[model samples]
Target: MANYNPYENMLQTLDLAADTLGIPRNDYEVLRHPEREMNVAIPVQMDDGHVEVFTGYRCQHSSVLGASKGGLRFHPDADENEVRALGAWMTIKNAIAHLPYGGGKGGIKVDPKKLSERELERLTRGFVRKIAPIIGVERDVPAPDVNTNPQIMSWIVDEYSALTGQWTPGIVTGKPLAIGGSLGRNEATGRGCMFTLLSYLEKQGTSIKDLTIAVQGFGNVGSVGALLMHREGAKIVAIGDVHGSLYNANGIDVEKAYEYANSHGRSLEGYEEPGMTRIPNPDLLLLDVDVLYLAALENQVNEANMKEVKAKLILEGANGPLTKDADLYFFEKGIPVLPDVLANGGGVVVSYYEWVQNKAGFYWSEEEVNEKLAKNMKKSFEEVWAMQEEFKVYPRLAAYMVALRRLVEALKIKGYNG
Candidate 1:
């Protein structure tokens, strides 16, 4: 993993997909770089009256399909390379989901957990103010990712609206419901992963009830995903968060666990219940379960631990959870590793819906939002599954092929083929 670069990982996948598609280099070479990238210095006034400067980045990978769309992550490890890779992955994700959008991503290098509420608000507003010139409903739209959430998005909308002197809820997504957020946005990513899993299992003539699952992250994506899968009659045997891991061989009560975490300061540090036992976080990955869901950060399943992952089927809830070598290792071992571009696309799909509703000034009911999200996720899974079967490649490579084909066609139509 010494030479592993997220951006290079994306490019390597793109090259493999292009080669498989038999596309000439001239038709797809332009996609190797971002269309535009901006680095800004954001100055915020701390509560103690001292001014601090922060670095932020917004990278638009492509706009050939439409205006760019992605998320803004607030994390200490965020950098130009990671942001660029995420932007490229967003482009592929949108294309895989068949959404009319390109790919873009932005981030500020700061640990949001360490900031006070007021300081966080000031930092979000400052970052928005700096990127406002390039972002809008018709230019680039951003949603919440990682440490960012609906509250941060609401702050951005408020700040952007104040600066422009107009109501533009469509300029950003993942806002609070009171401020034009979509009804089903919170659980969209997890629900999408669930739908994809069901689709794959159905194809294999397996029932959700027959599977046991272990989730490697208990954040919004992991917790919601575990709950939804449990609702579908799957046995959730184990779940873990950054704090620790919990296991119950007789199946954990996902709903109860979710509520417990929510009420206990958004952590599972001390969650207790009958039949549950504490385990090491890494041990959760090696659980004797039928499926393992990776909803944590990138590179969690790298070459070092590839052989330790015992799940027969792996689904990604986070972006780039598996390194390139880890993915290939799974493929060689005949373990199916679903790609994030297809598995976690529910969030972006609903973000598109929110953008549509905001533009139309009409809100959709939760039922409507959920129905449409499920349909889109199923369709995307089928397409990627078919591609994998046709190419005899891993799901990750197949997803890249599907997305690259769509992107290359759009670029050709725009006369960027040369």
Candidate 2:
């Protein structure tokens, strides 16, 4: 409903970050544009014998640090420019997380909910076939985003392997554990979000048990984040998905809601519990809670509804949840936002570990993987927090500073820019 362009949002953030750093425009102009953008048409044969062509886009924003790394989203709103913006964010995210990778993103313009399982599989294979030439273990690796999941990544890995006549589990991440996936892969993002939140709370001298949380999106990230927060003694008073939003004055039993939604194919439409009242999803955003988690689609928090936000802290569990204009609005209100790069960077952090394991032909135990991830995430968080304090800027811009600093170094070393 908002006339926001995500790419323009990204550029504004980049421009502000550059201005804060006082870097000349000529030094980072190359990063303002993607290195490569590929748009392809996948014509698939439906079970009814009709040919349907779906538009797909893959954008490699940068590769100076390492192979291009990002997720593949399947949604009706996906477009070339959106994918381009997401790819650019991927680069910034990896850099801020201090990962040895660049950024890329791809998406297909179709609502997976409208397609049957067979049709989804066919479309996945078709997409893999189309993009196989540009993606691989040492090249651009794709993971799951939006409506896509590990099963979709599995299909891509299988289809790409079939085309190349080899087994390369490293070619794709977020795959099921049966196919060389890493331990703690499923809950990595949510768990990492919890970790970062706790870490920030500790730094702020606030007790997690005393806070209230309102999560917008009961999907993988939000559900797990809410559940984890509940376990930590935080009261979850509001939650919502595409179905609707639900609130309880006391607290909704997150475990029960998760079970109901999981058994019902990830829908919270008819979920019933004591003290539960149905409300609009937008209303959930404005709920009075200490922590507001955005785990839904992009533009969920924008300029139009920015005035309604009531949370003191925002954890971006989803990518690009806050547009630039909305972010500035929140910043002016003294509401600190933990950007997606620093919050949701956990998933890709562990994905990089998975890739290393797959390449070395050895894997780490769950404890080892989690320990390594925690170390990396904590380090990244500390760096961003320090940057925020030093620059007297918002956390999002501080995160971009962390990433841009690293990226400029990489570019200098690569001789792309001096």
Candidate 3:
């Protein structure tokens, strides 16, 4: 996994999808690289009165479809390649969901947890100022990922608005409700995962109630997805995060786990129930279960342990959870893997809605937001499934095919100018 390059992984899938569609590489070669990438050095004053410089990157993989949109993560491992790959995946995800947006992703190389509140705010503002020139209501919008959230997004909106001298809430999504954020934006990604999984199960003439699931990652996406799945009557056999993992074949209380993680800095290190047994973080992927919901980091199930995975179904709630080889191993084994472009697209989809509402200066109720989300998720998954059937390929490839076709069509319509 140390040698795993996410951008290269993205290219592998992109090439295969284009090949599957019988499109020449030259004609669609523009999609092979980012339209633009900006790197910034943000220096902020620390609480101890010293200054620390941080590296940030914003990669726009495409603008041919429409405006660029994706998340801005603050992780210790955030880098240009990862951001670029995530940006490309955003393009695919948005196209899969039929959103009128391209793909862009940005992140800073720092563990946001290590920063004091004031320091973090200053660093965020500095980063925003550097990238503000290129982002806008209809250009590029960023949402939260990893250690960032609504509060962080609010800070971005405030900083960007301050710099622009105009009130522009659409410059970013995932803001607070009082600031034009959509009603269902917080749980959009996880809810989309649930919606796609349920749609798949329904088509198989089964229900989530009959499954025993293991969830890796207890953050907003993983925990929300697990809790929602639990509410649907699935037995959550195991759950874990960076600190540790826990297993209880009889089923763990997902709601309690959600609350506990929320109250404990988003770590599942010390929570224990009567039947729960502690396990290593890596072991969570190998657990014998009906479902493996990976809402964690990238390249988790790579070539090293792909053969040991026992999950009958894999739902990707995170971008690029499975390496290319792991994806092939499962596809050849006949297991249905719900790709991220289709499963976790609810975030970008709702971000699109939020951007629209921000521009329109109108808001919808939570019911309306959720209704629109569920309908889009179900329809997107069905479209991907149909593409999979038509192509006789893996769902991931099918999803990439769906997205790449849209990108190519857009390119043709726009011509090769600028």
Candidate 4:
């Protein structure tokens, strides 16, 4: 973290993927830089009669595929570099999911939890007003990310609609169902992780019921992924949050952990079970389990801690959970990783479906949505797996190869329109 830059990390992976794919540097040099980056000043009036100004950013990595799409988060560390990296990753994620979209991401550097509901709404509206000109239902769409959720998405939809004077739900996804949100949108990312893990196990002639797993991060994506894997009969021996980690050698009751998290502001700080043990946040990844579900943030498992990871497989539940060096280390160690682009793509895949429903005024049932998500995630995994086998490369590079190849071909077919 002392010298970690998310955008630089993204570029490193992009370069590695391109080099492995044997594509000309010119073919992907464009991806090294974002197409556009928008930073804005958001001024909000607090309940105490004071004005606080917040800095926010939105970056569009590419639009060669179609309109740009990604999530927007409110975090204390949100900045241009992080947003740029996230947007670039979104491009590859969309490509791997085979969706007609590019990548974009935005976030304000603030803790939303500290803001009152009214104040948060004002901040949301203010951010939308500044980014409004460049974003639209067909141009760019933003959804919720860390410390953001459906209620916040509803605010985004309302503000964007008010600015355009039209009820355009397509401008955002992951909304409450009443506002044209797709069913299963909330748990789509986690569910997609579950599907990918199951698919991997099925391919390996193994059973999920016998696996011991540890998860880092107990928020939306992490908790949902934990619960789904639990349903599959996997032993979730450890789980963690921003506060710290929880472990039970036999298995932690994911249901109780999840319920407690929901009841306590998504933090696992005070959670306890009969045999549960509290460990340092860093220790969660070192648990000698069958799988390490990295659902936290960037730079968590870089060189400083890569050697300590004992999981045989990793499911990237968060974007950039493993840095380039850690990722390559795992690959060299013969550990299989379901990379973020292919692993956590369920959120974006279902987001695409939500946008489609909004465009058609037709929504899907929860069962229909889950089926579609599983099918898409499984397909992407299989494609990435095939690429891995064909090139003898790690899953992450293989996934990037698949996505980068797709983007490059699209560029070749489109050629210079100028």
Measured on C-alpha atoms, candidate 1 has an lDDT of 0.93
Pairs in steric clash, model 2: none
Reference-based TM-score of each model? 0.98, 0.98, 0.98, 0.97
Candidate 3: stretches off by over 4 Å: none
lDDT (tens digit, per residue) of candidate 4 on 298-383: 77888888998899998999999888888889888998888898889999999999999999999889999999998899899899
lDDT of 3 by residue, 198-239 (tens): 999988999899999999999989999999899999999999
> Which 10 successive residues of model 2 have the least lDDT summed?
409-418
Clashing pairs in 3: none
C-alpha displacement of 378 in model 3, angstroms? 1.2
Q: Write the per-residue lDDT of candidate 2 for residues 226-314, one digit (tens) a residue.
A: 88888999999998999899999898999999889878877898899988999987899999889999999787888678898888899
The runs of at least 3 residues in candidate 1 whose Cα sits more than 4 Å from the true structure, single-residue gaps closed, are none
Q: Candidate 4 has what TM-score?
A: 0.97
**Two-way TM-score contest, 1 vs 4, winner:** 1
Give the Å error, residue 98, model 1: 1.0
Candidate 3 — what's its lDDT?
Answer: 0.91
Model 1, position 138: C-alpha lDDT score = 86
